[model samples]
Target chain A: MPAKELIRLSGLTKTYGQGDAAFQALKGIDLSINVGEFVAVMGHSGSGKSTLMNILGCLDTPTSGVYAYENIEVQKLETNQRSMLRRHALGFIFQGFNLLARTSALENVELPLLYRGLTRGKRHEMAEKALRSVGLPDKLRNKPSELSGGQQQRVAIARAIVTNPITLFADEPTGNLDSSTTHEVMTLLTQLNREKGITILMVTHEDDVASYADRVVCLSDGNILSDTLNNRKNNK
Target chain B: MTWNAFLIALREIRRNLTRAFLTVLGIIIGVASVITMVTLGDGTTKALQQQISSLGSNMLMIRPGMGFGPRSASAGIPNFTMDDVEAIREQIDNISAVAPVSSSQMGTIYMQEARSSSITGTTLEYFSINNWTLAEGRYFSSSEATSGAAVGVIGDTVRKELFNGEDPIGKKIRVGSSVIEVIGLLKAKGQVGMGDQDDCIMVPINTVQRRITGYTSMHNIGTICVSAVEGTDSDKLVADISSLMRQRRNLQPNQDNNFNVFDTRQIADTLSSSTKTMTTLLAAVAGVSLLVGGIGIMNIMLVSVTERTREIGIRLSIGALAREVLLQFLVEAITLSCIGGIVGILLALVICLGLSQLIDIPFAFNIQINMISFIFSATIGVLFGYAPARRASRLDPIDALRHE
Candidate 1:
């Protein structure tokens, strides 16, 4: 298939609070993410990067804007519809590796598939495959506390991708990991993006983490400061 | 969602065993207390009814007094003698048998030793009226009663106390310095109407009145036992006997009947109804404890919601519907209470068993009531758990994720 836009946003603006206490988090953001693209969003603290990620991940709605995923306007969707969209179309990876404590890796991966109402057999099959893809097949029965930080993030990734969603949204996916584990997680993400053709959006403050992406976008004070395609990295 | 998540939740509950047990304790105590109270109350009522029935269903007691009150000095108590008993027997239509008894606790002789026992002076009609049967020998004859002979029947308790397992029939016993031959030994009558029938020694009424007490007329007759004729309306019989006694005493129409008449069946009904009322009142009080248990569940669920804030955020972010989260927590609360209720029922059963063995009353454990209580407690868990579950479900994912 031709390069189709999986996520599209136009003139997106999000404001917290109201009247005198009003604060704008995102200012007229316009962006499009194509299918199978690995894009990185970089910004300083309080630079609207996290707000854009939140909107992109469907965790929040923009104060004023149009957000469309796969040709469907997400801002106008109902609460249940948004939940369904998140389950069937978009996946999220948090910086804290927000895996349920005391839950096994396979069960964590099966969480999203449970919302999809899959049968027990089918859920196990999908969760096993997802864990295997993240290179943690042996850690399926281990809880998050038992796994290394990178292993926990892999379990989180397995959970996000188990539903085979249209877009994967990762916010500082390696923020809690050391340099070695960060590289290992980023390599896994790169391999998943290239081999499975899954669209990836990553947010980070580290330039080294952003360097793994095919395209990099920088934001400052609620405005996009740069949007550049990495032709050299793409060629390599 | 997946059964795995439910399994995980259950596992988590098991892991925090102490908290789970504490959470269920309220329900356990509430259910157990209800069951114990109901079982014991039912048993006592049944025992009382049985005791009343054993006294003869149609038997009525008539005593010379204004209802049940203290005896007054100015009240001219009518004498109930062999003549009055004969008069009532010959005059009344519903009277099947009449026994005019004069009783006193006398220092009597049994096996050559003096012992304290009741002496009742009455006719042979007393045997049939009180459903008494002879264990050995025969009752006093009408000739012996009329001739004022000193023949008497001894109850089983008196026989045991006096003879010490030997036969007392044809043996002579002394009552208040008067020697009387035991004509028979009565069959064991456990106890009836607050008095031990087995401890009494019966003699001819005229003989006891003339020889032992040295009185020709007895003022206070130990309750006159009357049995109604077959197919006769007992209430009407009682009313007729009351009127006849009043006329015999020469009371005016406006005056209250000077004698108190109590029917065994009526007393039984009254006792049962009162017991039913008491059971209902105790159940209502126990129900209040169940309500408090529900409130305890709600309070704990609220705290659980607060504690699991981050977990709720994680689940929501992973595509869990708000209603799904609500339902999971609700199920958890219900599970806790249902487990507690089951334990309570078992405890109640054990308690009922212990009570039946320990007390004189028969305690019955109604399975239907126990089941109803169990279901009621589970429902309370659900009803109370809803608010906290809803609060957790409606939480903003971003804010919840940020919650410490």
Candidate 2:
């Protein structure tokens, strides 16, 4: 089956400030990703990979460009409308497990659903289900500070997938974890992709982490340097 | 204003429990001080007005002085006499009753137990004009006043001093060289002006002129207590009385009259207005503290916003709008100040009632002032809460997220 296009970014250019001090973060970036595809964007510091992710995630807008997602104009939507889209159709995981401190894991997972105007009962039920799927059913009442690094990442993963968005944007999702816990988190992401068919886009500098994605896109100096499909599969 | 925002606001406040409590201290003091001053001032005004009204309504005190207020009684003011009282009684159109009151410290009372008390000599109409009621027995008859009989009505304090709560009616109490029979007890009037209304002895002006004082011609009366007919224009009565005094005193039209006619209502009004001004001034000063309280809340809230920058970023990244973050802090601020307001109201109530009892004045709740204080407190919350909330909302999500 021909893969359906989910996001299209064309001639996207972003510049900070103006005149002498202007810094170009993203220059003429054009890329397309399809439904159910796991793409890992590889870049070093100052490579503008995060800028592309920000534009795609609706966290910020490009200075001059066109960005369309699922036939809807991403650049023209109002701030509230973009917030609504993010609430309904996007999810994010960060390098820093940005869980609200002193809050329980269940409550952390339920935070995003609160903006959707769901009933408290529904929110609790769904949060419980998401935590169980992330293998954190017993850790629902524990706080992030009380959990190990791997368990905390699992809680963060539960929070990311609680809304069931079409695409999951994970920016260095396993960056803060040890090597063994990083494998555990990557295995969870692979299981979610294979089992639920949810699309995933991650940004990382580690080649081992990038190898988990089906395709690797490398960025350097504010532009994409290469895009290639991965051949090796280590589901075991 | 949404339910989630409200819940979030409470969570933030709970997150910094001790800080939140401390931040509201300024507001608490502000509201309490302002409301307490106003409430107590209102009570004092009521108490003062009541005391003035007890002196009798629609009555004027015509003293032999140029000025009318407390500062008017200078030592050199010429005295009015019985003749002037008669002239005013005869000339005024709405004049109901007039009594010539003459006071002298020269006479002292002696009984089984003796104490020095001022003696006042006046006509029987003085009882009616001053609204004095007889606690027991009866005032002296007009014949007793006319014939200069040695009969007297003892005030409450005189009875307490000389009689010690024993019935003194029909008993003899000596005044100077004369042994006067106590015929009546004047009802207690708490206090009025410079002297206790219940501390003086009342006898016939004629008797005082002949016996207690050497002024035998009845030519000098200290003040004339004039009562107008009920519902008469007090201003007109005062004008008529002033004109009659002027004519009797032989003053020309251009001269400031020697005698001052003062209204009880006017005195009460002046006293009450000054108290009101004082209350307003106190409230304004306390209102500055309210502002300071608001500023304190603002300062703390700004720090909290900066401290929670990453949390704000997380909420923004997960579908929260700028206004949602704005609502969080605004609601938090309003909660802080509203708590302060309610607590202030409670504290003011306790302190006001306590002080009123301590100082022996009536305690009254001024609902309007309390409500205004509360509303002002809420307004302070909004006013001071805005800047910090705006700063929080205007933060760039990406930059905030990247903040360590």
Candidate 3:
């Protein structure tokens, strides 16, 4: 009920199996993310970070607990209803830069907008604008294979923000890039967050990657180890 | 949404054009063979029917014994004689003309050329019964018939073979030690009923019996061709001829009549129906290829779904509905088969044309068959395509994303 708590998770539990084979990935975790916040979740391997990210991104259901986005009950929404939420409210970028192969960059960026019922002309215009904003207007017709890794990830970024989603999820987005390219991508994300006021939630293991977020949430063995506002990274 | 799906389908096909073409090959061969068989069969039947119809619907051929077809013979039955022909011509009402016909597969004949051909012996009345119009010269004269004149008329093939386009109106040809002058040259009437009707020569029945073979029984003959005058009932004429033959053969009520009277129209009908049956059988056999082709499409689609699991995951994450993915794959299947159908139709056209010309029958394009094969292939796409498309749509997004 805080002034701008856009996402709230309370007593969230996600287990992998039944009986003796059961693996509880997240154990009664509670977290709140405010509007326009860039939050990075960091943890070691087997620390339940990916499971928690999956739940927060609405890509997976929790075994038990409450998940609400903007006060709407996400845990209770049906599959299609959840799909609708994802379509209208969320955008995702993957570690692999999940661009469709054999498709041009502009077409890849236009993919999300196609489901939003935009006219053909509007879809093209917005896709071109999104590509230009990501600094790839000249490479609009280049396929993923034709572009470098940094450029491909830029196309994926354009795809993510083209629909003007309420929240963006980046899963180890810079993990596949070189150190210099990673800096560029990180700069692009910070620029998008500062200029567009888009709430960003990223999952990463690197301290350098997490250093760009306004806040950091650290998990250890299915439980939150630390949650702290990062004065060093906060742009506002 | 469908338009977007269609575009996706088009892009997918274009991405792997070779695989798409191979996937549709079964349909192409299927439709091509089917159209070829059907078109040629119809052409042959058409040509036969036209030839028989030109022979006149009202004509009946009375032969020895009760026979269903040309080669079938009712054993122990006697052959016909000229007395039967004369009796029918004089006693039967509605009878316009009647002629006794005899034929022999004679040995090689020589004059200007040497060739062996069937020799038909009949009178000028044979012309009227068969409605055979002369192209040149004249028919049999009564004096020539009574005196057994050694004169003949050559059909187109015999003219080509022995005459070599030389005027056969007065030239002489030798037939197994007998010499005959070609007094009339018949016009080109192509193969009718059976083999080449133009290959054989026609002469007076008397000339054949007395001069050629020396079998001089005046009443004995071979086949009788009879025609009815206008305004006569077919059934009545058949009954009149049957009763007359029965009486002439001296068959009691318990005994079987030894002669056969056949309607030309009935033979034409039977021939065409049999051809229709053959066409249906051939088309059905070819239809199985279409089924296999559909299955090929489904198999490839299932493989495609597996191959693109992560791609599908990306689409789902990007907010594509399950049905949209389903529609996209379904469109691809339909597009594949429909293209195959179109190619099959074009291939069939070329094949049918070549075959019709090769077999010397008229090429008949049946629009109904074209429509049926086209729609049937399209339906095959939809029916076999749904299973794989549905499998793609029902894929779990999490698992799909995890799939390598």
Candidate 4:
């Protein structure tokens, strides 16, 4: 079956401050993401890739743009409505891991499902399955502080996928991980994309990290520099 | 959702156990002191009522005064006479007993024991009216009271001082240079609000007039004691006695009566109400501290919100609504204060029990006040916790996640 369009952004612009102090982070950007696609967004410092990620994740709104997610006018949604949309349809992974310190890994993974009002038993079951998928089944009771960087990131991945979201936004998911741990996390993401058909939009600075994606979009000075498909060996 | 917030709040408080305890200290002290004050006040009022009731049952004291207090002394007013007491005894309805009393402080001696004691002279009805019961010996015969016989009844204190616990019946004790035979020894009536009830001796009014004061007149009676039958409205009784006294004294209708008839029950009520007023005042003063305690909680909660900005960001970013975050913080504050209130109530219980025993008052536990205090403390939590929780909920997820 042909892939379905998941998200579209047209003429998107984000400005901070005013007049002389104003800085435009995204200037007239147009992009389309398809379901089940693994796309990497690459940019240098001051290139506004992170800004685009923020707007796409619904953590922010663009100054003037049309942002449609599954044909829903997300830009016109209220803050609470956007929250509900993010709750049910989107998941996020951060470079810092962002696991709550001193909290058990299982509980951290179960955080999103709490807002979804799932029963405790059901939430526990789903969170455990997600942890097992990320290869941290035995680390369910370990706190973030007690876990290594790679293990913590795995816990973050488990949390992001625990809700079975339609789209996953990973902002430098492997930035803080070692090369070996990076390969392990990238392989896990590849399996989830190719097998589970979960669409992913990732931002990265490293070329090798971008190599995991099926397509690469390079940004420079708040505008797209290149959008190209990548051909990689089926190493997995 | 509320339950989840409650659980989260409990975990947060547990994580910072020491800080939470310190934050609630003010509330604890506030609740404990208010409860203690109100409890002790109730105990004192009860003790006072008990003591006053011991004075007499349904009794009235007709004193030769306009009213009680220093300004109302009957020094310029005429004293009640035996004829007035006689008229009440014969004429009034619902009346049980009547006695005309005259008292003088005099030196009494029995063998080597010498003491200055108050000597009251009244009829046999005085003992019944004042609820006095003799421990031993017999009261005087009617002839002894009528013919001015030199006989006396000594109270417990007088017996202890003059006779040294020895049976003094039929023994002679000199009162103001007159030797009087002790016919009866009164039971120990303990103490009341006025003074020691067992400190005076009672003889016939005629004996006091003829022997002690050397007056030999029937008009020397200082006061009259009257007791009504049970179930008689005391207000009506007072009115009856006043009217009788006014008629016997030949006072004009327009004139203010020269004497006062005091119902002991009314005195008890007045005294009890005053005690209640004092308790309310003390509780109110203690209530001020509860408000201060609420402010303390607010201050710490504000600090807590600032410290947990990043944690709030994480929750917000994970699809938690603003009100959910607000509920979490609000529940935490209310839980903290309610815990403080419970601790305070328990502390007050212990303190009231110990202090009541120390101060010789009844220990009164008022559940109503305790409940009011608890609800008030919880309200304080809500009142003070609102601003901080609202601030937490209104936080921007992106900015909050960026918070260090």
Candidate 5:
């Protein structure tokens, strides 16, 4: 299949507050991501990389911009419609590995499907499959507190991808892990991106973390400073 | 979706057992106390009515005064005569029986026992009018009553006090310096609010008028006991008796009644209504506590929203609708209060049973009241839970995610 543009943003600007108190988080920015691409967004603390990901994931809206996701105008969508879009088409992961405390790993993976009104049997089956794919089949009934940090993130990944969403937005998913666990999580992400062709957009500050992606975009002061292709051992 | 929300709510409640209990404590106390108050009130009302009915459901009492107070006794009011009793029995259409009654406190002695008791003087009609029954022997015959014979029937208390459980029938006992032969034993009527009903002696009216007191006057009757036929309206009977007494007393057109007629049913109704009012007032006060309980739930829900901000963010990011989030919290609050309500109802049931037994009143399980209390507590949940649930749903995912 030919490469197709999945997301397009032109002159996107987000302003918080008004008058003298107004703070511009995202300045006039133009960016486009293609289908099946693994893109890494890099920035410092206040570079607004997280804000850009939040917008792309449909968790927020831009103040003044044209945001098109799969030919749908994201900025024009209602809050509920944006939620539906996120429900059916997008998935998210956070650095904290935010799974409900005291809930089993399998139930954590079944949260989104619960919202989708799936039956208990179907949800249990899918959740079990997802946990197995994440290599925590034996940890299905273990609470997040009982799991190691890497295992917890794997459970979060299983939760994010259990619905088979078209795109996955991961914000510093390995920020809380050591070097070995970070490699494990990065390898899992690569496998999901290559084998399943699920588009991935990740945010990171470390070059080693960014190297796993097929392309890299660096933002400074909410504007793209550089966009470059990354040569890796195996590029899809 | 609602069922899922409910299950999530149950899980959350189970997770924080102590906090949930503390949060719903107000509701628990509220519902329990309300039910207890209403149930006990109904029980008391029923007990009172039963006691009154034991006095004779269709019985009426005619006194020689306008009101039953100290003023009437001090005014030297004219007493009713046997003629008035006879006229009422013959004139009234719904009358089942009527008897002229005269009573006095008299000292009675039998062998080694001595007791001060009320000596009631009436005829055979009094037994049927007041629904008294004989436990042993027989009442005085018409020849014995007409000849003013010294014969009487002793109540159960008198029987026990004087005879000491021995058969007192056909025995002689001195009553007010006059020796009378006991012809019957009256059945025991348990002690009630008014007084002990089984601590008196019954003799013939002629026997008391002619021999015991020896003060024979034309107006010797102190009261008239009149019982209406079954299914007769008490108000109409009272009206009929009032007019008959007025005409017999020769009162002018503008004159108020110089006598009083009392209906046992009216007393029962008044007592029942007063207790019902008291029950309603107490339940309303308890309902205020339920309101306070709702406010408590709101306070805890607000804290829960703050404490679980990150969890809410995770859910929001995972495509949970804002409304779905709202429903989860609302269901949680409702579930907490409903659980409290259920436990409260069970607690109230136990309390009512124990108290009824302790206080010697009837135990009445009122389903309407229990259901009302449960539904009210749930309503309280919705009324107070809306604000905090809305706050949770309206939270921005970005800010919520950043919360610790």
Candidate 6:
């Protein structure tokens, strides 16, 4: 990769269970992700794609590997240090949106900023900016139950990016949305990547969802089967 | 992590209004009951002490006996004569007033109609020594006391019973076949430690000795009322009386005194100390209720921790520090207890005020007890709240998130 790399993993391995019953989730996988790269990881069930995403997001440590983020060795970080890294450098979007119900969208976005030690006024201001950037400025006062599926996902996205983290991790971000809303959300993500140069690493099972990314890496049986670049015209 | 989190936690408590109220009810009842009982006990003790002190601190009582020794039903002790009273007055240094009292169970008293009452015979100084005041007529003269005259004073209850609301002063009341004219009606003095003071008729000592009981000398001198001189040594006065009685009876140094000399002030001190000990015991029993309330808080908090596992996970995953989680839950528990304590204090005040009005004893509102109850309830919150808060904070985010 010519561009500056943001994540590099070498000899990454994850094993579960004991002795003879041990099953490896990720076996000796090596990968590099460059800055501002829009990558999608596609896999069948039990293919270790989720494990890779977890290691990439600093949520899990590889049992035997050297995982580096922007030249910093992530595997050696303490538990609190790993959490701090996740707080300062990573944003996450889950398939279920995972937004706390009965909470306003603004408050939902303010959650991450609250942990950053920002004052009330500054936290609210940053939350409003993030929600506005996600094109939901008018929905700040609305709760998760009051918003549509696509609007709720946008609030989740705003919450993810409120801390201005270095990389965005979306695990099946549009899996629960309708076909039309899926296209709408994908266009929004693509625009965020092109306009703001924010790195996007997404995991999805659907080929159509993976096609929205600039590059795709496919996995089967805990091994990367293919890595390809797309030449399609920009959809947005 | 920030004050906003605390504000949010407070708002959350406000949202669950019913749960919050129910959660604090235990602490409320606990604190209020403690305060009310303590206040009532203190008031009763204060009233008792005040009543005892009002009975004349300088007065001493000399009852017949060898200092309250074992009683002998077969043979009675020698009666105190008029000469014994004179000898004590002559020998004692701080003798202010001396009166010899004799009592008999002459059942019925009659003014116009007949009623039941006890009759007592005493000298003139009995009026001042026992805090008696005449309401309608004059007290008996010293001449009447010496010449064995039939003059008498009637108490308020006796007057009411025999006179039937009519004036009893200067009226002749027939007592046990002897007619004695009432010289004075005593002012309304309420009951003291013994019983109702207004249930007897007073006659001259010589008259009761000569006519009613028909004995040359008084046998049972119920009590010898002695008042100490102002600014003189009361202990020296008691010692002088003891020495003079020893000389009169020709007793050796190893022999016990033949009479009991009790200072009313000492009795007052003894009564107050006993009241204090009783009040403290009652307060300690009431304090157990507060402990039970604390245990209730702990039980409820532990259940809340178990119920909100997923919520804790969500907060933790969203970047909430373990300490922040710990503090949030702890504050919630404390808020519940503090609200309960405040309401309990208010309730206890109202109850104490009502009880004071209904009872004879005064109900004193003590601010120190109120503060202590509040602090105690808050301490209960902190102590009981710790385990649940720690459990919530120490939960594994991944495991908690996956909890169904």
At residue B31, give the lDDT of candidate 2: 80
Quick one: best lDDT, which candidate?
5
Where does model 6 sit among the CAPRI classes?
acceptable
lDDT tens digits, residues A133-167, model 6?
A: 98998999998999999999999899988887779
RMSD of each: 4.7, 4.1, 5.0, 5.9, 4.7, 6.0
Those runs of model 4 whose alpha carbons end farther than 4 Å from true positions after fitting are A17-23, A44-47, A78-80, A174-191, A205-214, A228-236, B1-27, B45-99, B104-119, B124-194, B198-281, B307-309, B322-343, B363-368, B394-396
In terms of DockQ, which candidate is stronger, 5 or 6? Answer: 5
Candidate 3 per-residue lDDT, tens place, B269-370, comes to 788888788777877776676666656656665566555677777878877887777787788778888888899899999988988888898899988878
TM-score of each: 0.80, 0.85, 0.80, 0.74, 0.81, 0.72
For residue B121, give model 6's deviation from the true position in Å. Answer: 4.3
Per-residue lDDT of model 6, residues B113-199, tens digit only: 777777888888877877777888988888898888988888898887788888887788788878898988888766678887788
Candidate 5 structure quality by residue, lDDT tens digits, B1-404: 88988777787778778778876786787788888988988898888877777788598999987777765674667889989988998899898889889999999999999999999889998888776899998998999889889999989999989998789999999999899999999888777778988999999999998888886884778889999999999999999999999999999999988889999877778877887887788777877766676677667656666557777778888888888887887887777777889998999999999999999999999999898888887777666665655765676677777775
Task: List, residue by residue over A1-236, the lDDT tens digit for candidate 5.
Answer: 88999999999998889999998989988999999999999989889898899989987779998999998999999878887888899988889888898889988899999989999999999999989998999999999999999999999999999999999999999999999999999999999999999999999998898999999999999899999999965564
- Individual DockQ of the candidates? 0.45, 0.51, 0.48, 0.44, 0.56, 0.27
Candidate 1 chain B superposition, TM-score: 0.79
lDDT of 2 by residue, A16-120 (tens): 889999999999989999999899999998899888888889888889889999979898988778878888888888888888887899988998888777888
Query: Candidates sorted by lDDT, descending order?
Result: 5, 4, 2, 3, 1, 6
lDDT of 1 by residue, B1-404 (tens): 53644654575577557667767887787788788888888887788777776666478887776666465223676645555566677887877888888888898886666798988888888888787888899988889999889888988888888888777888888889888999898888676667887998898888888888878765546578888877788888788878878877778989877677778778778878998998898888877877776677666656666557777788787777787776666666777888999998998889888988898677686887798788877777666556655765676566667676
DockQ, model 4, C-alpha based:
0.44
Q: If both were scored by lDDT, which would come out higher, candidate 2 or candidate 4?
A: 4
For each candidate, report what fraction of the true interface contacts it reproduces. Answer: 0.56, 0.52, 0.44, 0.46, 0.68, 0.18
Interface RMSD of each: 2.3, 1.6, 1.6, 1.4, 1.3, 2.4
Q: Candidate 5 lDDT (Cα, whole model)?
A: 0.87
Two-way lDDT contest, 4 vs 5, winner? 5
